[model samples]
Target chain A: MSVIVTPTTTGAAGAGDPTSTSPAPGAAPGAPAVRSRFTRGPGRWVVLVLVTVTALAVVAPFLLMLLNAFKSPSDYSTNGPLSLPTELYTQGLTTYWNQVNYPQKLLNSIVISGTVAVAATVISLLNAFALGIGRVKGRVWIIGLFLLANMLPQEALVYPLYFFAKQVGLYNTQLSVIIIFTVIQSAFGTYLLSSVLSTFPRSVLEAARLDGASRWQVLWRVIFPITRPTLSVLLIFFFIWTWNEFFIPLVMLISNSTQTVPVALATLQGDRLMDAPTTNAGALISLIPCVIFFLIFQRTLTRGVMAGAEK
Target chain B: MSTTTQTRRPHRTGTPRQSGQPRQPRPARRERSYWTYFLPGAVLFTAVIAIPLVYNIYLSLTRWSGIGTPKFVGLHQYTRLFSDELFWTSFRNSLAMIVAMVVVPTIIGLVLAAVLFDYLGRRFRGSVVSVLRATFYLPQILPVVVAGIVWGWILRPDGAVNAILDAVGLGSLAQDWLGDPSFALPTVMLVMVWVQIGYPVVIFMAALGRVDPELYEAAELDGAGWWARLRAITIPQIRPETYVVALTCTIAALKVFGPIFALTRGGPENTTNVPSYFAYTTFFKKLDVGYGAAIATVLTLIIVLVAAGFMVFQARAERKDA
Candidate 1:
């Protein structure tokens, strides 16, 4: 519920400095470690093999899930969860997919996550505009409040939120989740984005102001363009984080029609135990979009992960 | 980290140029209108965070069951908490979580990052090093619940791990990992270790990148072993990141819920129960919303105290380095 990790120092993440961002360690890595390539011949291979094995171990569960997702229940039972499927049996996939209306869950996830991303980024920009660029009085206390909000576990807030949603007729609606997550995710966005914006040059703002640019105009025309990259990073993160969320959605969206992917899968446990193959298939399906996102945004993600942690 | 904060600290309230007669009329008007920009966020924050926090804290002082009305229980819930054995177990599990999420991962991540950055990185093809780092970090990118579900599948009684054990004639060692009372918490801890390894690795590797390459070179030239170099240079160089990782992960460990929900739901006689999960069940399953709020209040207080302790420790550490 509270997995937001940031570089303790504010300016380090979005600062326009080459040395701060994490690069592929294999590609250039860093410099001046003279004769870094070890002269210890066979031992180096040992290290490489050992590291590769560890990596494989780290990813082994996903591999097992993938392999078994295509297996028929009979294959799993007969072969005892070890053998390759005699044939591609995707019935488990289709069965589980239809059973929980997987496509609906997928759509709900996409809609809720996407909406939260864009909306949270906008709110974060607005907040940062005041604190970072506008330099609002008592900004430190405000930023600290947002940070505390980010760190406060959802457990502390969930019951009241659930009660309120019911009172407002939002208990089972996607809009309820969106509203909650947009605010929560932006709590983090505000913290990180404000840190980046605090260093915004006075000269740039003054130049825009001298051009008769209104505060809104300067924000949209001047600051937004400059801060687009940071906003983009926040957008991607909010989408992924919201998609991965569990507890609130679990409590809020009880019906299958309203449940998101992970929540749907968890509800499967509540009713009756799913067969091995169906569970595997469901798990695999739930992770595919995330894996694809990882592949596509590898560089941005790699950069962003280090951005908040390195500084 | 200290340097950045220190430089920003002096011009706390307003800019240095505003020292005498303040700023120009245009600037002054602009500054005042900044409150408008803050209005939307302020409104949202109050509704979502501020209100709920105060409401939950108030609820902690009463007894409610999600119906009728909440009766004022005074400090009874707090007193009951002192005697609740389940409460103790939940906290004990949190300590174990800290071990799984922070202590072990940070140690392994430090070694792995060092080996990757210092040894395998320069010695081998870049592809191998990059591939390994990505693989280690792969789990970090997933919804932790998704990762937990997969591990649940693997560790089931007749699941992949047991099947592998049978295939290798080690079936005797196979057990129902999550179903067993004793093994449930440890199995969950082990799974958490897998889920957490990547975070520290990514942070530390990035921290290691900033280490002056000349320092490693100098140590090597002086005939220092890799272990010696790690102790003297690598650890000290990345101490700030270490502090960040420890602080963030400790709070995260204490707040852990998604994985417990997906994998065990604090089951098998509640051995794997955490305070977060306990609060959750008390609220929804057991219909003890007030007790849940009390539990939440306790957890939040502990997190606050722990975070404050870490900040003080970090400040002292920075002062020593200075």
Candidate 2:
């Protein structure tokens, strides 16, 4: 939510804004006066209605999924998809969960996303350290290279990676996807972190160095503490991104035990055993963690997005 | 090289020996050791990204089926790709994707961001604005496969959308959204629009933050309408971000795979086949490795060109703005 309100706060006009030409009633100094076009009566209602309708439309699919997921197959067939469920039917969830080995799939997703997030963040920190604070030669070129790597489609690299994983006997293992994503996710991380680090205050590093801090110590003790916020944002993003990854994991982690939640659910699409309610249940289960993450880190995720766009 | 090292050696040793004298270390010399920090990332990038990219290109020039020696066939796959009808259809469908993912979303998002910034933030409570934005953005947080699953069910013949359409007495409009050739691509496009709209809205809202509020005030003082002000000030002010959003979303549109995989699998006469899915199925399902690489290479080229074009436009726009 600060995502919406932040623009006003960060906008040019503020409480201390010295450019207050005409003060409005009970507003921060220099804030826009109430004379704007749509702020008046009737227009405000129109805008509110439009925005609310659009938001409801945006959420319509989720509502449909939720409604049907708990509806029994018999209820759905008799009354159609839009009707209310007769009871709290949970057989769909249990059937899909048991069929897909939900716990194992969740574990696979967690292990892969968790490992990739930490490993990628660490790798990116090091990479950014060299390119940003160290001001390494060809830093611009190197950062550009990382940016390009991030932009390249997974299709371009999937086959070769698949072939290599088979050759190296790492196919069908969660570790393969973990390692692959660590590099891929860190590409963006390095790009973002390098840009952030490039603008790091040189005086702080100089102070640390003068206090007898070695290069490694400066990285750990000085830079790490200062950049923890950005790093945490990157960590959450990496974890979620890795969890949501599909193509590579679909190709590499082909086994049931190794497949992540998304890959597992996706493979069951249109299967003989899957009912409408079962697919909905599976999808609902898969996105529960993501919804939870969104609720908890709404501010952080939005901040990261802003940071990325600005970068 | 020897002479240069010899000249620098005494300066380095002398600096270390003079550490007790409160002397500053040569920043350039200190930076040299940081090279070691980049080693692991470099190796990983080379193996994961660079090498695979180059190898994929190499494989595109050869004939292989994921087994045996890849026999080098000069320009064979490229020629085959040029003649492939499905390949042509896939690229053509990418246009639909661009409209859904880039063009429509950007327009709607710009206006929505303006509303949130210009009207809602000023009129409503902060919580209201936040809740509205979150509702718009909720789909973005879900995995694409989850989105795919949810939309797939909703758009099914017996699904909620059709059921609602029937109940509303618009039964004639109800059809098999994903299974039919005619409606599949457009339905998928609609889903893509939903999946993508929040991204630009969020980014543009942030862009709007950096905009000068006084512009709106100045325009209002001149009696400009809301749309007039948005047109004259907000769009021009955020052209840079518009470019960024367009480029990133276009690239994502071209590279779309998961939604297609989960929703339609490029079925109903392959009407919804985009390049990424085409390449994926060709590689894995059909076992046509070289052709898959060719498809991926073509898609990659198009994306790079689009990105370059967007950046050049952004640069010119920024220059004009400045």
Give fnat, all candidates.
0.49, 0.55
lDDT by residue for model 2 (B235-269), tens: 88777567667887888888998999888999889
Q: What tens digits encode model 1's per-residue C-alpha lDDT throughout B1-322?
A: 3233544654454366434323544643544488899898899899888998899988999999988889998988999988999999999999999999999999999999888877776566555666787788788878888778778888899899898998899989999999999899999999999998987776777667667777977898898988999999999988988887899889989999999988898989999999999999999989988899999999999988898899899989888978
RMSD to truth, every model: 3.9, 6.9
Best by lDDT: 1
* Candidate 2 off by > 4 Å: A1-40, A299-311, B1-23, B26-32
Clashes of 1: 1
lDDT of candidates 1 onward, in order:
0.82, 0.81
RMSD of 1: 3.9
Lowest summed-lDDT stretch of 10 residues in model 2 chain A?
A1-10
**After TM-score superposition, what is the CA distance of residue B196 in candidate 1 from its true location, in Å?**
0.3
Give lDDT tens digits, candidate 2, residues A48-78.
9999999999988888888888989898889
Could you give the TM-score of chain B for each candidate, in order? 0.94, 0.90
